[model samples]
Target: MNDTYSNGKDVIRITDVKLTTVQTRRRTGAISSHIVLQLSTDAGITGVGEISDLDCYRMYMPDPAAVKMGIEKVALGQNAFEIAALHERLLAYMPSYFRYANTYPPFTPASQIAAGVEMAFYDIVGKAFGTPVYNLLGGRQRDRFEITYPVFQAKKESDTERYLGYMDALVAEGVTRFRYYVGVNFEQDENFLIAFRDRFGDKVQLKALDFQGHHHWKDVLRIYDRFRQYGFELLESPSWREDYEGMAELRKRVDVDISEHISSLAQAMRMIRAGAVDVFNITIQSGGIYQAKKLFDLAEAAGLKSLISTTQEMSIGTAANAHLGAVVPQLHYAGDPVGPLLYVDDVVTEKLRYDGTQLIVPQGPGLGFEIDEDKLAALQAGLVEWDRPAHGANYVSD
Candidate 1:
């Protein structure tokens, strides 16, 4: 109102921020949090945004209080229209954000602080213009985005039966494609893939990954062939994350299209230069909407596709990724926007749903989602104050 409105674009000034930690009721080790930024405008148009979780690649979980404080320090009194400046200021305050955290220098810390801020900035801008975030990202190329559901890695014959039975419920809900990471063993994992092909092969799409990355190059080659025979589309992270040389050689050796699990943008460039990766399993949390879109463009420029990957986030993160995924034209593979359906419950009110094989992107302004106050309140009420416990797979019970 003071000087940012000389150009008639400053409608909102930052007022307050809120953080809520929600724990899963039905799952053992799956708990995620949310950060809400409330922007109070001179015109009384309150712009709202929710921070998506970015804990999978972080060395430590983001303290929501710290993120809220960071946001206020960077965003106070700034014009909401200055999205780029806001992000650049954020970068200057803390440089080198990660979709996944890095072990090197010249990089900022890896958490959802920047991502949450980015989403809120876009949300304010979108509502001011009466448009969606995808439109802000150079317009939409497609209406719906394809997704891959996470099936628990089955290691036994009975485990395969249980996986099938679990998928049966999802199939009824119109899910046609699903995937899971490799458990601990290959032979046991092979039996699981064979079951999917034998049972639901013709009815649904299939994808598999070995994120454990324990297999040798020869082992990866042999396993890729075995699963390819069963009609698995892509094999992801079959080896270690830094095995670029091995991945490059394997890409040339096998018929399976291998994807690299990228934590840093440099990792992505390395994969592209090496001609190793077939697709990118990227999370919006890796670098937020801006860098992720650029990464997708880089992949398409190199004749590959970028899949908006995920690892158990709430509806807010899923919605954020969906907005990015909606605009990208190269999202031609099974995506990991599978959070709302992954656990027993999500904290947002209007959670995303999968109709058949695709995820329907929310069409509202900004992230296109509203905070489920009732759900949030309930989660807050039910939250157990636990000390730092050993964390494990979100679905796997310890």
Candidate 2:
């Protein structure tokens, strides 16, 4: 039955689902691969979403052609606005499960397949309600939010110069907040910190992300003490992600705030209850916009601050970050939403514009950007190879 909802809006059933592979240099400085997801409704309304994944999951149907066919099988005839239902349905039928640390969310699709599907639902629902996506998630607290530029550590000299140049360019563009990966060399990390202090002075807000738990819990204090005088902002994933006791103790001892990416809302509750985190950092990768909103609400209830973390998602995924930023009341816009800033190219017709350090959240319906069909075609046609940089040195290597 293709009937209208009781709210007086016409029911828009998802009639088609399509996914495509695009080749581009992602924010992590890899000429990698990403999937663009599109959902078409019976009423002719179309929604867009995108996803990128590392080698974390090996699909039985690795070919995009086959996956697109599978998506249609799972999505066709379903209500486009039933976000949670759609998310659960997609994950309930994945060919592979999320294969990361044991502490992360379980029963999730390994790749960005679930993210793309979830984003599509948000787009359809927002368009259906004639409001921005964040409006559908209990309204927004801010009209705009801030994002940080990520500095990826590289071993090549040219890559080093390029990243430094990228930093300088961002500073010229009025970016005032930055996050640098804390590499293995403490002295080198300290050198980068000193140079950053000398270059940007106190005008810049800096955060140290140990994507790899490089330091033992006892020794972590040693490193923190050395940089404590500089007023280093935050330390993330220092020694172990699931070491809640260590993280809690560090929170009690150090001058720095601690944060790490968690897998599930239940785990977030556990982390909050254990007093393990100063800032609740969750990515859009796990459950897309709907679940991300739930996580923020949980953080708010627990009296903990929350922020959206990105794995350098492309335009659609990054736009999802801004949508989340606008609505999450407890968020400070302190996390990284540097997808457009990191990518050499994007699929959106209108590229995102930054107002100094802040990313201007698009106010239009759905994810606030239109797809560039020609650009999509060009990227799909130019597919040469796909690569993802390792996540961090200590925990999981990509």
Candidate 3:
């Protein structure tokens, strides 16, 4: 798209690029790191983006140290408003890393890189036009959205008590929905669910988000039967993430909602055809913001519910998700962009605001957060000491 604003002289050209790598700690003491992208324009406008470290998909994560030169090659000296063409160039120029995972859609780390770049470009465009990124995508659909608090697997009584404490605090602040990890120790999980319902009562909602879905459909049915009385509205990935047939079989056997991560548009379609899931959990990691919109659009067209999933991103990445959450019509349920609330510290000058369970969509000109350059520099300096893989924690449970 060409730059055509009310003022003929509003065009901005990207001049320089900077990539800052930063790491933050999750509430559970897990390390969460991101590569923050900054683009400087000739018109004195700067845009920011973030590339998050996805836990299970770490093998597919591109080295941030190596991504800068590639970004410079594709993004430098371009008209800042030609984001579509810029995105095309980015996709063609960056490495896709398709062989890292043997999954259905294949893990493409390049998409994450593209997403970071696209996020920066969208920030620049929104700033230039003096509007929020959601307005640029479409008009705002909702000012605020619901969010589900993530609670890990409770292995013992103390674990359950600790989680209950967290939930009580959140509930006092207006949070009512929670998601727990299952498929681990069934007896402990059952006990935790029982305690959870007893503590919060039926006014609160619970859902299961499992990372290990290696069980057979019959086994999954048994697990579901055990937890059915607790009133779980949804169960995500009861079978393997890509096991559409198995998921379809399970869906037929139970009335509880099922959800799967949409890695690609083709995967969503396949799942839809198989009647596998009642919901599709999408994240910016699936591609960039635009690609996520496409997947959500597809899910809505098929009459399936969708929610914005998280990769445990910090403020900037969460800001981008906030904009998506604002415009996406199918995002009817609670999203998981709990980074601003969960991260110990963030690179943004002011983290996104969280009110109870809802994350208020940023209303500023760009992705709505400013970079903390000093913090970014500090994080980069300490990168050599960290083995990211060794410090990584599970997204659902650890």
Candidate 4:
């Protein structure tokens, strides 16, 4: 509707834009790389944006290179306020090589470009309104969010002691809720849950487990039976994606509530229509703010809870998630907005902070945070060469 930032002009020229990668180390032994976008106008006002790469399925997709070339090719001399137009143009012009193995798959490399452009557009809108994205979404519902700590693969039984020690320190630091992985290592899962129960003894009210689609339906049911004794709040991805029939059946079997990792709003609607999940894990990078709001509205109508989860994304997506989680009407569960806390360092001007169990939405203009231009330039200068990988680590192709 109102393009106030455009000064009543039909078009705002996109003067310059750049993309850089920031690598953050995670305790899970995986390094996360964020592709940051900087968009500037002729009037000197600028916006920041980011997108998450599809690591599990489409890890070979070189999203940063596509994002860089896509912005350079389509964003120049265009109106930043014309978000829809820019998004569509980028979608049309994006190289077909970036698409996944199957053309019909919902998640693809093009989706990343579309998400990045949408976020950049949101940044433009936020800067124009002089309000944070959260305020624009629907005002703040909660000042903070409960953090969900991720526990990946554990080596030995003794490793559970180290993990408990780590959680103990975090609990002292004001984190009350925690989520542990329940895949591949059932012993670790049992040990961690037992340790949590023994040490905390129900002091931690919120405890959950995530299977990440690494277990069978029967195994999930068995795990749920065991987890019920410990009073788990929820279980995420207990079954595989596209197993709605199986999920609905498990919903009947499991004593604990189930959450789905339906990344896009389309899948969310499908899950709701199928009555498969009790909680919806809304990821902003997978679906833009508009679509995310639509998904939240649908979830509300379907009487399902909402939890803002992370995709190991950067500050741009994290800021957007915080705003969405703060403003949404049906955010019943605490969000997994712990990317900043999990990372060793971030490449943003203002870092997202945890207040007790919650993360406050930034009150600054635009996405409520600013970009570090110096750090961005330095990161761009550090890029030696970029190429798209194929298949596995051994396969290399442009």
Best by TM-score: 3
Residue-wise lDDT of candidate 1 within 181-275, one digit each (tens)?
67466687788777777888688877766455556666788777666777777777766646777888888887767876565667777777877
Cα lDDT computed for each candidate against the true fold: 0.66, 0.69, 0.75, 0.66
lDDT of 4 by residue, 1-398 (tens): 44554656545577888777765555443455557787887756677877653443343646566567767787888877676576567647753312221111233555555666677777777777677777666788776666676655444687678777777877787777777766656776677677778988877764578776656677788877776777778888777647767888898887777887655655666677777899877666544666567667778888888778766555667787777777887677777777776665667776777776777777777787787777555544221124433211122322
lDDT of 2 by residue, 318-390 (tens): 8888888887776753777777777788778987767887788877878877789999888873223334333
Best by lDDT: 3
Question: Residue-pair clashes per candidate, as listed?
Answer: 2, 1, 0, 4
Off by over 4 Å in 3: 1-10, 55-61, 94-108, 155-158, 211-213, 378-398
Model 4 weakest lDDT span, ten residues long: 97-106
Where does model 4 exceed 4 Å of error? 1-11, 27-30, 53-59, 90-108, 374-398
Go through the candidates in order and give the C-alpha RMSD of each one to the true structure: 4.1, 3.9, 3.5, 4.9
Worst ten in a row by lDDT for model 2: 98-107
Q: Could you tell me every candidate's TM-score relative to the true structure?
A: 0.85, 0.86, 0.88, 0.84
Any idea what lDDT model 4 has?
Answer: 0.66
Worst 10 residues of 3 by lDDT: 97-106
The better candidate by TM-score, 1 or 3, is: 3
- Arrange candidates by TM-score, highest first: which order? 3, 2, 1, 4
